[model samples]
Target chain A: MAAFIQLFVSGLATGAIYALVAVGFMLLWQTSQTINFAQGEFVMIPAFFVLWAIKILGVGFWPAVGIAVIASLLILGLLFKRAIVDPMLKHGVLPLVISTIALSIFLKEAVKDFYSSQAQPFQAMIPSEDLNLFGAVISSQSIFILLIASGAVLGLNKLLNGTRLGRAMQATAQNPSVARILGIPVERMIMYTFLINALLVALASLMISPIYLAKFTNGDTLGLAAFIAAIVGGFNQVRGAIVGGLILGVIENLAAAYISAQYRGAIPLILLIVVILWRPQGLMGRAEERTV
Target chain B: MMDFLTSRAFKGRVFVLLMVGLIVLPFFLRPFGLLLVAMWMVHAVAALGLNLTLGYAGQISMAQGAFVGIGAYCTGLMTLAGVPYPIAFLCSGALCFAIGWILGYPALRVQHHYLAFVTLAFSTLVFLVMRNEEWLTNGIYGLTDIPRPILFGWNTGKAQDFYFFTLLMTSMLAFCVWWIIRSPWGRAFIALRENPVRALSLGVDTRRYTLMAFAMGSSIGGFAGALYAPLVQFFEPNSFSLTLSLKLLLMVIVGGSGTFFGPFIGAATEVLLPEWLRIAQGYYLIIYAMLVMVLMMFCPTGIIGLGERIISHLRQKKISSERSAQAQAMGQDKVAQTKSDTQGGAGQ
Candidate 1:
């Protein structure tokens, strides 16, 4: 029971990171209808930025993280929008999808070539101390991750639901032409979505780097996890992504412990197939009517 | 001129020329070159199948490599177990057809990126299974020394002999694809691609056609894999990874999706270009990735599409110039008619 609790808690922490990435994924899909195949790389790249700042530039941890976040927002968010997404989007979703896949390869290869291919140990923001809860020991890092991830999600929720900018973003998502007609800057709103997504992924990178390590290949698994989590929870809903991420995290940990550890990666994939086959609108998403 | 360029006679002549090239080229090349060209043919078969699926039917699949892997493993294991290579090859194709048909169920439910994810998940799962199932797949150790096929006392164990065999097989497969594309089913697939809803309204049975596209495409991929097993003689699960699938996709896109000759050109570019780019050493893949990104950004329709665009643009220019010349001639005729009318009226 204690072991189960431990697994559950750790899974929640991991799921929280997946949830953060999934939210960003959902935002991109909502506003621009882009399934960014390079999203895992987005999470993977920021850790290197943080690493570069601290190791190469001799910056402090918090300040390095700040530098990483701002840089990610500009390069990954703004540049990605202006360069890849804006140009390829008009060609339709398939081209955009191909472009993103190409972007993923580019990112992966660039990192392996330019940065160290070897996994680098990342510094944890929180001190490494065990906290006892209900006869299960939990790391302070996991606790910190959970707190920060939830806070970020709540803050994002408040931004989307409460602010005028958020409403404008939502309007653009619903119908870009109508939103533009109503005097909202549709392109700018989409750009903001990209920025917000970059911010979320950078945060996710910081939270996950210590646990998973900062590695070039980290994005392959992390990106797939986010996709599975988002789909399982509900592709369309932010809340669904959160629930899905938590469920996936807990399930993956349990499967690793109780089931065959070698085939643990297969578990989520099987879950994905089942969910796609049985409930494609997702557990939380609504069935959308074909617009045309 | 355009009619001649697109005519059956011209295509037939091109086909004969290509066949002659295939038959005679190996004589001048070394054994390694023979093997590379043979590998290109094998990948061309896979890319051709993917073209049918993604290009013709507009279904997105990231699991083409997985299907190819399934074909390879099935043929390798069966041939190892004393089954005839021909029988094993057919069985492998059959297996992929059934599996791909079942895989198409998810496609019926979702479209675009959702479908891509479903296939991506499938490919990953297949990879995990192939990597983890030590008892069946031999895990990371991989099955080895799979014997090449013998056809009517013709042993294709030699590089030159295998190249001829692969060439013959590729030509047959290409013929089959050509026939399919010219058939009513091909028309139905185009309809499905252009607009599924409209196709359904027109009673095209979009569901069955969708399933057929998946089955046929996957079986062709399986056939390619079967050929690949004998050609390479040794391959690990990593050979059939997502990278292979992406490469197949790259071939289909670069060559020109939906065009009959696109896969061949695409496969050549994929297999040979990297070899040519090996001068860049470690930076070859980075260069390749950037090239693909630029290609997708500027010419998503691919190399074939770009050629077609250039041809059409030139044709349009020619037509416009001819039209202007005709208009000038007509203007002169109009002036002559007016002068005659005025002269006749003055005389009256």
Candidate 2:
């Protein structure tokens, strides 16, 4: 019973992180009608950036977090304009897709080559306190990660439902041509989508800094998991991503705990394939038609 | 037809003869250098095989690396079981073809990026299996102590002899590819890639052709992999990762797809690019990835595309000059037309 409770809580936290990443994936997908394979690379940028800041700039955790988000957005703007938006102005999804894969490789290789050779734990940011719930023992860091992640979802929900710009984002995602006909600046909206996705990645990196040590390949694995969750949730739907993340997290944890750990990653992928074969759309996605 | 044969046919045959003469290169070239070229030729042949699917048929496959791994395993296992070297090599190709045909079933439904995802998954699964399946693969230690591939009554364990063996097999495959492309099956693949609906309307079975493409491409990869096991005398899961698959794609894209000689150029570029950038070793991977991007963007059609553009440009300019000359010498042009009328072949 205690093991079950322990699994449930940790699963929720991990799911929360996936949901956050999925949300970022949806943000870009929604606005531009293309998914960034480099989206997960954005997640690592913040963790590394903040780590760099705390060590070099000597800023406290909160201040370092603020600076990291800012720097990421600035760099994101440049890449969004130059690498992505400009060349892709008149192109199909193919070049953009291939370029993102290239970009992901670049980001990963750069981190591996230039950054610290050894993996570093966020000892400075993560508190070492233990919190016992019922018969299970949990960490303060785990609770904090969960709360912060939940808070982000809540805040994003409010922004999407309440703000004028948020409506413009939705409008652009729903129908780019229609939005253009209706006088919305579609390009600007897409640029903003990239910004928001990068910012979310920064936030996710900061939130998850406690438990998982950030390494060059950490983003690659997390990004793949989140991407799978995003697909399971439905490619373009934000709510679906969040739900998908939690469900996958629980399934993964339980599978790992009960079955073999070697094939832990394979469980969700198998489920995803089966679900896709059944639904052809996702668990929560709109039923899509195939031309063939 | 006779005139056509006498013209470029003479030149083309001469070129082939010259190339065959160059095949005696191992006598003069060092064994190590010959081996290097031999290995590059193997990859070149494999990439050409991939081009039939990825480039010509427009199916982006990521399991080429896995197929190579399978071929290597098959070769190693067969050799270990005391099978003859030639039979082991042929059996590896056949086994990989079967695997590819089975894989092509689900792969027919998926297209573009989604198809890439599934193929990528296959490669990853194969990688994982090779790492964890101790009984079969020895859990990443891989099959070692394999014997070298040899021809009948000929020991090809030496670098020079093995290089010639590899070269002969590669040349034979290259010729086979050329012959296959000249057939209706190759046309079907190209037609399917360019327009599936049109090809279907014209009574082409696209699914079968796609499967054919996958099988053909994968068999070539297997052939190369089979040869590679004995040549290197070692195998590991790390050697057949997704990175190798990506590099194969890069070779096809950078060298030129569709054209016969493009894969050779691409294979050369892929193998030599890093060696050329030896000084900037730390930035080799980043530079390589960036080069692929730039190549994809500017030369999406690859070396053939750029070359075609330049050749067409020159041809167009030359034709225009002749037309202008005719305009300036209208009386002489009229006399030449009468001469053609007297010659009786008016159809041309």
Best by TM-score: 1
Which residue ranges in model 1 land beyond 4 Å of their true spot? Answer: A54-58, B1-10, B324-348
Candidate 2 at residue A282, lDDT? 67
| Number of clashing pairs per prediction, in order | 0, 0
Tens digit of per-residue lDDT, candidate 1, span B175-221:
89889988999999999999999999999999999999998899999
lDDT for B62 in candidate 1 is 87
Looking at candidate 2 chain A, the ten consecutive residues that score lowest on lDDT are: A88-97
Worst 10-residue lDDT window, candidate 1 chain B: B1-10
Local error of candidate 2 at residue B167 (angstroms): 1.6
Q: Per-residue lDDT for A234 in model 2?
A: 81
Report the number of the highest-DockQ candidate.
1
Residue pairs clashing, model 1: none
lDDT of each: 0.90, 0.77
